[model samples]
Target chain A: MGMMKHLMVRSRRRSLWMMHFCLGGCNGCSIEIMAALTPMYDLERFGILNTGNPKHTDVLLVGGSVNHRNRRTLKNLIDQIPAPRLIVAVGTCALTGGIFNEAYNIIGGANRVVDVDVYVPGCPPKPEAVIDGILSGLDKFEQ
Target chain B: MTVSVIPVGPQHPVFLEPFQLKLVVEDEVVSEALPRFGYVHRGLEALVVSKDFRQMTRVAERICGICSAIHGMTYCRAIEKLLGITPPPRAQMLRLVWSELHRMHSHLLWLGLFAEAMGFESLFMQIFRIRETVMDILEQTTGNRVIISVNVIGGVRRDLDAEGADGIRRALKKVAGDLERIRPVLVDDYSVRKRTEEKGILAKERAYELGAVGPVLRASGISQDIRRTGYGAYGELDFEPVVESGGDCQARCKVRYRELFQSMDLIRSGLDRLSDGEIQTKSKEKPEGEILVRSEQPRGEVVYYIRADGSKHLQRLRIRTPTFANMAALMDLLPGLDLADVPLVTLSLDPCIACTER
Candidate 1:
C-alpha cells in the first residue's frame, strides 16, 4: 500500500499521460481536448500529454455520447490503462449524452462503461475547462 | 511468418469515436485493412423528422461538436431558403465571424492531435496552449463553448457590438501570431516531416474519385472550397483556398496549417466589414420546400438536406459530414502504410466517426 502511494505520487508529478476515447460523440469535446494540447493552451507545462498507447497512460479522458457499438470498446480501454488511473468524462455528451440523451442509438454517457473520476460539462467543454479537468484529475491521483 | 488480424477500435486509445479497424498485419506492415462504423448511429436523420425546426438546431449541433456552428448554420440556411427569408446583413456577418472562429479552433485542435499522433509531445502541448485563447474568446462571445447555440432559423441569436468585435479581432490576431510560431514546428521540423511526409499518400486522382473534402481534398491539389460558392459572408470576403500538391499526410497537415491563417484573415475581414442591423428576421411562416445547403466546416464541406412540409417540423433532414466522404479515402490510405503510421495517417484526415455514424 505504501509503495503504491509513493508510486502514485511519483507518477503524478512525472507524467500524467492521457488517452482519450470517443465512444459516440460529435467530436466537439475531443477537438476541444486536442485544442488543450496545442500551442495556444499548451497543457504540457503541467506534464499533461496525450498517449497513443493506453498502457502508457495515467488518465483516460472519454468524450462523446456512449452507444451500444462503443460500450465494450470503452470498457476494454478502461481496463487496459494501468491502475491508479483517473477517468475524466468531458462534454455534456459524455456526462449525460446532453442533447443526444434521448436518442435511440446513444447509450447515455461514459459512466455507463467505466467509473468516471471527473466530469467536465459542456456541449463540448472549452479547452481551458478541459485543462482544469486534467489538473483536477491529477489532484485526485495525488490524493 | 503468420498474419494476425488485430482490431484497433470501437473504443481505442488513438480513436475517440467508436469504430472498428480490422488490421491484417504481417509483422509490422499492415496487409489488409477493414473499417467498421455505425457505432454511434443515433438516428439523427429520423429525429429531424420528429422535432420542430427550433429543436432540430439542437439536434444538428449535436451531429459533430467540432463543426457545431456549421451544422447549425447549414440547417438554418436550408430552413431559411425553404421559408424564403433572407437574414439581415449584420446577421450574415455575425454568422461568418462565428463560423470562422469555429474553423480556427477546429483546425488548431486537429493540428495538436496530429502532433500527438506523431508522438511529438511538446508540439502538441504548444499547439493546444494557443487553442485556449480561441476557446476563451468563443465562450465570452457565444456564451457556450462547444455548442454555441447562436444560429437561429432566419439568422443568428447572438450579436457582437463594436467593442466585442474589436476584442475578438485582437484575439484572432494573437491566435494568428501563435499559429505562425507553431507553423514552423509542423512544417519545418525534421521529425514531423519524417513521420508525415510521404506517409498516407492519397493521390490527387484518387482523392477526387473518392470525393475527399476539405484539407484532404486540398492536400490533393483540388481547390474545391464550399466558401467559393459564396455562402454566408464568405462571398464578401477576399480569400483563396489553400492547396498543396504532395497528397501525403504532410500535405494534409500543410493544408490545415495554411487554413488556420486563412480562417484568421477571414475573421478579421468579416469583422472589418461588420454592419449594424437586426440579428434575426421575424419568420412566423413554416418552410414548405426542399433545399440543399452546403457550408465549409472546419473539417470540410458539410451538406444539409432539408425537406419541409409547410409545418414547424421538418419532414426530413439528412447531413453528409466531411468525415463520411473521407471514409472511402481512409480505406484506400490505410492499406499501403506501415502499421505504426496507421493512427497518424487516420488522424491526419481528422475522421470524426461520430459525425459519420450520426
Candidate 2:
C-alpha cells in the first residue's frame, strides 16, 4: 500500500506515545487531556507522551461516552492498540455524546467503539483544542 | 507470602476517571480494598425524563467537569428554592464571585493532581502555573473554560462588570501570590511530608461515621460546612469551615491547603460586595415541589435533589456527589496501604469519578 504509507509516515514522525482513555466523559476531557501536559499545552513539545500503557500506545487519547458498561471495555481498549494505531477523539464527549447525547447509558461517540483517528470537538476541548487534536493526529500519519 | 490482586483502575494512569481499585496485596501490605463504579454512568439522573427544568441546568453542568460551576450553582439553588426566586443582590455577588472562582479552580486542579501524584514534578509545574490563573479568571468571566456556564434559574447567567471585577481582583492577586509560594511546598515539604504524612487515616469518629463531605469532611476534624448551610451568597460571605485535626493524608493536604487561602478570602469578600442589581430574574412558573440543594463542592457536600413536576419535565433528579460521599470514606482508606500507598491513598479522596459515576 504505497510502501506501507511511507513506513507509517516514518514511524509517526518518530514518537507519539499518548494513551489516555476515559469512556463516559466528565473529567472535562480528562482534565483537558491532562492540560495537554502542563507548561502550557506543551504536548511534550511534539514528541507527545502521556502514556498509561495501551501496550506503550501510539495515540488513543479518547475521552468519554460509550456506555453499556464501557462497551466491552471500549472494545478491549481498541483491541490492545498495536496495529498502526491512532484514535484521538478528544472532547464534546469524545466527539458526539456532548451533553451525554440522550444518555440512555450512552453509545453516542468515540465512534460507537473505535475507528476515530481525530475529532477533538470542545464542550471540554481546550488544551489548545487538545493540541489541535494531536496535531491533526499527526496528519493521519500522512494519510 | 501470597495474596495478590492489584488492578488499580478501569483505565488507570493514576486515574483522571474510570474507577476500579481492587487491591488486596500482602507482602507490600494492602490487605483488601474494592471500589468499582459504573464507568462514567452517563444516564445523567435519567435525563430527568428527557431534559427540562430548563434543560436540567445543562444536565447539571455535565455532572462533573471539576464541579461545573458548582453543578450549575446547585441546580440553580434547587430551581431557586422551587421557584420562590430571590437572586438579585447583583446576582448574589455574582454567584459568590463564581463560586469562589470555582473554589480556586477546583483547589488548583487538586494541587496539580496532588503534585502529580506526589512525584512532585516541580510541584506539578507550580500547581499548574497557579491553575492558569484560575483558568484565566474562568475564561475572562465565563465565556467558557471547563464549563463555567454561570448558573441561571432566577438569576445569574453572567454579569460581573467593572472589567470583570478588575479581572477578579487581578486574578485573586495572582492566585494569592502563587499560593504563597506553594505554602512551604504544600506544608513543610519533606517530600510532601514524606508522601502525605501518616498516609490515609480518616478518623474523627470515622469522619462523622463515614458520611464525609467536602475536604473529606474538613479533613476529618469535621467543622461541617455546606457553606454552613447558608446556600447562595453563603449568607453574605465571611466564611470559615477549613478544619483539620490530622484525619491523615496530611490532614487531607492540610484541608486543601487551607481551602486555597479560603477561596481567596471568598473571592475577596465577593469583590467587596459587588452590587448594582439584576442578572436574570424571570422564571414565571413551572417548578413545583421537592427540593434539597446543598453546595460546597471542591470535592465535598454536593447534594441537589429536585422533584419538581408542575410542567416541563423533572420528576426526580437526585445528584448527591462529593465523590458519592467520599466513596464511603474511600472504603475506609483502603485496608492498610503500601501497595505503593495505592496512588497516594487513592488520590487523597479527591475522587470525582465523573461526580461519582454521574
Candidate 3:
C-alpha cells in the first residue's frame, strides 16, 4: 500500500465510526448495540463513535435479520459507506436469522444481502461480545 | 405556503428501530404526521404455525428484546389459561419479581433514551450508568440480561436463592440511590422542564378515544394498568398505578420515573412473598381452546391471543402490542409540534416498533 493509504488504514483502525441499521428481526440486538455505546461497556473509550450518516461510517453494524422490505434500505446504506469499510452482522438474528429465519417475508440473515465481515453470536449478544466482534472486523478491513 | 414533507425514519439517528414518520412541516412547525411500518416485521405472529406453542414462548419473547420476559410471561399465561392449568403460587411470585425487575431496567433504558432525545447527553450517560446495576442483578439471578428466558410454559425456569435475593436487594438499593441523585435533573431541572413540559400535549378524553395504553394513557389521567386486573401475584402485591395529569411529554416521563420506584417496591414485596415451593408444575396436557391474556409490559399492556386444537402448534397467535395501540395518539400529538421537537415527543411515547410490526 502507498504511504498515505497506509496512514489512512491505520487511522481508521484507531477510530472506527459505525452506523447501525436495523433490518427485520426484534429489538434485542439493537438495544445491545446501544448498550455497547453506553457507559458500562464504553465503546467510546476505544475511540469508536456511533454515527448516523452512512458516508461518515467506517463500519456498518446491522441488527436484526434481513427481510424483503428492509433489504433495499440496507443495500442503499452499504452503497453509501466509503470502502476500506467493515460490515458487522450483530446478534444471532443477523448471522443466520436466529428464530425468525423461517418466517415468511424473511430472507434469512445479513449475509443474504451483503457480505458480513464479522458475526456476533447470541440470541442477542452481550455488549462485550459485540465490541469484540466489531474490533475483529476492523482487523479484517482491507487497505 | 410551501409545506415540506420530511421523512423521519425506517433508519433514523433518533430511533433504535426501523419505523418511518412522514411529517408535514409548515414554517418549521409540524402540521401533520403520518407513520409507516413493516420494515422490522418478521412475521413472528405467523411463525406460530411452524414453531410449536411451547417453542413459541421464546419466539414471543423475541418480539421485543426490551420487554422479552413479559412477552414470554403473557404467552405462557395465555397457554395456561387455555389448558386450565395454574402455575404454583411461588412460581407466580417469582414471575412477579423477575417481571418487576424487567420493568425497572426497561424504564431506566427508556429514561436514558428520553434524556438523550432532549439533548441532555450527560444526564443520559448518568441514567444508563445506573441502569447497569439493575441489569447486573438480573444477570446474577437469571444468568442473562435483556431477555433472561426465566419464564416458561408451566412456570418460571429459575429461582432466586437467599444469596441472590440479598444481592438483588443490595443492587436495588444502589439503583434507588443512584436514581435519587439524578431525580432532580430529570424532574425539576429548568432545562428538562423547558424541553419537555407542555410539548406534545394529549388530552384525557382524546387519549381514551385513541386507545392509548401504559404510560401514555396514564400520563393523560387514565389510571388503567392491566396489573390492576391482578394477574399472577399482582393480586397480592400492594401498589397503585402511577398517574400524571400533564398529558404532555413531561407527564409521560414523570409517570415512568415514578413507576421505577413502584417497580422496586413490587420487587421487594414480591421477594417477601416468595415462600418455599416447587417452581415448575409440569403439564403433559395439550392446550385445546382459544384464550386471550393481557399483561403490563414496560411499555404498556400486551395482549396474547392463542387458538389451539389439541395439537403441538397453535392454530392462531395474535399479539396486540402497546405501541400499536398508541399509534393514533402519536399521530394526534404530532400536528402542533415543531420539527425539532418531533423526535423528543415521539420518544416520550416510547414506541417499540419491533413489537408493533411483529
Give the number of the best model, judged by lDDT. Answer: 3
- Tens digits of lDDT, candidate 3, B266-313: 999988879899998889988998888899998899988888999999
Which structure among the candidates has the greatest TM-score? 3
| Highest DockQ scorer | 3
TM-score quality measure for candidate 2: 0.34
Residue range A9-101, candidate 3, lDDT tens digits: 788888988889988878888888888888999999888998888999988899889888998989988999988789989988899988999
In order of DockQ, best first, we have: 3, 1, 2
Task: Assess each prediction's global lDDT (C-alpha) against the native.
Answer: 0.83, 0.82, 0.90
How far does residue B254 in candidate 2 sit from its true spot (Å)?
30
lDDT by residue (tens digit), candidate 1, A29-107: 7766766766667777888877757799888888877787778767777778888888999988889877777777877
- DockQ for the candidate 1 complex? 0.54
Task: Find the 10 residues in a row with the least total lDDT in model 3 chain A.
Answer: A134-143
**Using Cα atoms with residue i matched to residue i, what is each candidate's TM-score against the true structure?**
0.89, 0.34, 0.98
Worst 10 residues of 2 chain A by lDDT: A134-143
When just chain B is superposed on the true chain B, each candidate scores a TM-score of 0.98, 0.39, 0.99
What is the lDDT, from 0 to 100, of the residue A3 in candidate 1?
Answer: 100
lDDT of 3 at A67: 87
Interface root-mean-square deviation (Å) of every model:
2.4, 7.0, 0.9
